[model samples]
Target: MDGTLIVGVDGSGAALRALDWAADEAVRGGFPLRIVHASGWEWYEGHEPSFGINRDVVRAQA
Candidate 1:
């Protein structure tokens, strides 16, 4: 109640499901939900890289 709900996104089905759940929870709780996608691997480039942080370390700091 004192903090916020933060979710991570990896473009996976599970991630999408989590997003849906977060949205629902936000609506019910009357709070805001933050969706974060972290894509920092070498394979993820261009738009993919633009989605999230580069690695877990960076996200943890955030």
Candidate 2:
């Protein structure tokens, strides 16, 4: 592939599994891995106290 391997992660078990699979594929295919996390709290009506904190933790783990 000519493009990068993009993976979406939400700090969940499923997202982590997908990330690991994507990373493996990226390594085998020689593609750059891009991990993305979207916090939709800003667009939502209610507040999420763990939104920002979770992003920080995810970033550190990444």
- Evaluated with lDDT, which candidate comes out highest? 2
The reply for model 1, stretches above 4 Å from the true place, is 44-62
RMSD of candidates 1 onward, in order: 8.6, 5.2
TM-score of 2: 0.63
Per-candidate TM-score against the hidden true structure:
0.61, 0.63
What lDDT tens digits, residue by residue, belong to model 2 across residues 1-62?
Answer: 88899999877899999999999999999999999986555544554666545677645755
Residue 2's lDDT within candidate 2 is: 80
Candidate 1's displacement at residue 57, Å, is: 24
Residue 52 CA displacement from its true place in model 2, Å: 12
Candidate 1 accuracy as lDDT: 0.75
